[model samples]
Target: MRYFLIPALTAFLAAQTIRVGVDLVSVPVLVLSREGRVVPDLQPADFHLFDNDVPQAFVLDTSVSPLSVAIVVQANQDVRAYLPFIAKIGNAVDALLIGEAGEAAAVVYGDEVTVAKPFESGDLSLALRKLAPDGRNARAIDAGMRAIDLLRARASNHRRVLLYIGQPADHGSESPLDELRDAAETYNVTIHAVALPEIGKTFVSDTFSLQGLSSRSDRGGFKAGTDLGRLIPTVARTAAAAQSADPFSVLAAATGGTQLHFREQKQLEDAVAILGIELHSDYVLSFTPKGTGYHTLRVEVDVPGAKTHARPGYRLTTN
Candidate 1:
């Protein structure tokens, strides 16, 4: 099984990660035939895995794998009107995102980062319902870092994931966005997010969309090297191409996850349902590589006219 990562994608993982090394590099992959349906069966030999553009040996996993998901939400006054709906989403998340086999932890940020539900104690609904918007500032990056910290402590058998629900841009995060992104990359964490605007600004999506990420009928539309160009941007913050006006988009794209938009209750619910389907259908490819520094990841499928979405890269350090 694979956990998930990539270079410059907005986020899931090789679709995004892998284990079996000092630091696991897991990449979740979505393979769609020309007909626009998920390609369920494929051997490791049917696909090629590359790190820093060089082909490497890998193990392919295409089954139901449990996840260790960290749910991070914004609890600032800016989105106060939507808090009621956000609070109630615990059921949807349980039924759709994590399910029975997976475990999840929750973190809410307003003036500070608060852990509403820990991994072991899991009544997310009650914890979420108790949330009350506290400060004027939105500390999204800080909240994200906290979520990553929680996920890192989990068992490696579970796929590492982070779900961010908040405003498009950061407001008062003392930590730079790159710091959080680097941490996510270093740990092979796949990030997915839904950007919430202030009250009236709901429903309108940002410049990028996940609508076509996994489904495109045109066989010529997407192929290897087409998606996940660079899963993780250089942690050094040298790559301006990975920069985004909306901070969530940067984290999502670079981590092999998608950044979605929603202002209404239905939009949020629909987003969760869509994410569930996407996550479950992925074919994860994992590898143990040598050396360190930043690694670029690329995925190639042998199936004809198959479009693939994968995490682009991950960072590794030798102890």
Candidate 2:
């Protein structure tokens, strides 16, 4: 057997009460076809459960229990600047919490993670509406770690999910990416990220490109061959762009979650609507692992041309 171990396993165990034991290996799976439609009717026989490549028997839990969702929002200055122009997130929040048993927590992140509103079974639109941006920096990576911790500790049997809405950047985070990946697997938390890009934001490159400075222009149209004045702005823009690239996809992929990107505010609203349906359509699989440590989970549909989207596997903390 090939053993793949994650670093810092002991530290992760010391931090939180991670789900373990032979019976707690619950895997949530989403079945989809090649044409992008959700395949909802798959039986236990369709799935081949494995713990470290060893086949095992498992049961499917497609219960319609109340969903435990943490809405982690990024509230940096730039995102807050265009907040008014964007469509009301309340509509999106409303779409997610459609059922009577739906519960949600509103967490806003900047330099630090703040649970603006803890999990509540009531409607979250009002609380989300009242939320505003704070601090100068964004710490999406750190906030994500905190979100997973919150969902794991929640005293509910309902399916746990994290809805991250923010620009894909981590300015200052106490946790590293590897640790975050471990945390997600440790808790079996599913993360669905919605990338919120700034609209109409001005940058040095935008200005230079507007003035006939193309990539083909080696000197960037500077008479001195290089404008010292543009250096800082150019570097700043480059760093910002690099940071804005998708940082949460790995966590999403590891957690068997989907990542949605929006071009328009309306598209965000529509995506949220679609997510509402997907949440209710998931199938939860519970299996008893033979032992502890990290286990690989592969869920496939017997149907031809069907793709399965699920977390790679889970890491059970064993003493």
Candidate 3:
């Protein structure tokens, strides 16, 4: 049986009211081919959107809008060991700011999360320099939630997106996944997670190795002739660590964001290149929710073999 910290659907489905004289909900969607290439020039009629499972009136906004991006970097001991690789993140920022009016902010998650740089359009050399990894407790989930909240407050007009650069593991997080999902939907913030498994090598490699040994000992006790007594304790201790590899991926999917896992430094660079192009080529749709209840969203395109990716839904507040 699986249990979630936050009521998954309810947390994301906050009630939202029609603002001012408008009752439009804006959704940004990415249309990609099976090969991961962005498909452009999609017409409004090509899309069919359902709000709370009800067909809704909608329009597509394909104009190149300015972007407000929040970059979240994890700063834990394991990440610190891979500083040389983390330093390359500076180049990724350059690739991220593709639009003429794109602006970005950086947040570092260590013992405590800190806003390393306020939103700016110019060079990010100084801010990147200040983001050194050092903390023992890397509250990745908490820091990510705070970063989303900050982006929610500061970047309302622009297309808001969070670029999370770290391992999926959260050692000490005050904010739970449910709250984070709620905030992401409430603010219409899209998350793009770049998982650096190499940075947290010690934790991932060692912890999982123990888990594998424990599993083998259990399954092949007779043939392998391993001690079940010692292995059971090892499995119990490393159980929490096993869950660390999947949180960011889940967060990304829930918020209509993409998760890229990189094994080599070059893979990260290549993934960033594709992401930069995809970021500039999203379709924004506006639709009004049917009622002031929890609403689910679905986007379908008429293009053959084309896939559409967007947020699952948002909360409609009765304010």
Best by lDDT: 1
* Model 3: lowest-lDDT 10 consecutive positions: 12-21
Global lDDT of each model?
0.70, 0.59, 0.60
The lDDT of model 3 is 0.60
Best by TM-score: 1
lDDT of 2 at 49: 67
Task: Estimate the TM-score of every prediction.
Answer: 0.80, 0.73, 0.74
lDDT of each residue in 1-319, candidate 3, tens digit only: 0112113211211111111112467777766554334455568788888887777778776544567778888876777755556566564555344333567878888788888777744355567666676668878878887788678666445777888878777878898877777777777777787777744254321111111112232221111112212111110113342234577765665667766656555555545544554465567788766566557788888877666777777777666
Candidate 3 segments whose C-alpha is farther than 4 A from its true place: 1-23, 34-36, 120-123, 198-245
Model 1: lDDT equals: 0.70
lDDT of 1 by residue, 33-60 (tens): 6544556546788888889878888777
Q: Which ten contiguous residues of candidate 1 have the minimum total lDDT?
A: 1-10
TM-score for candidate 2:
0.73
**Between candidates 2 and 3, which one is better according to lDDT?**
3
Count of residue pairs whose backbone atoms collide, per candidate: 50, 1, 6
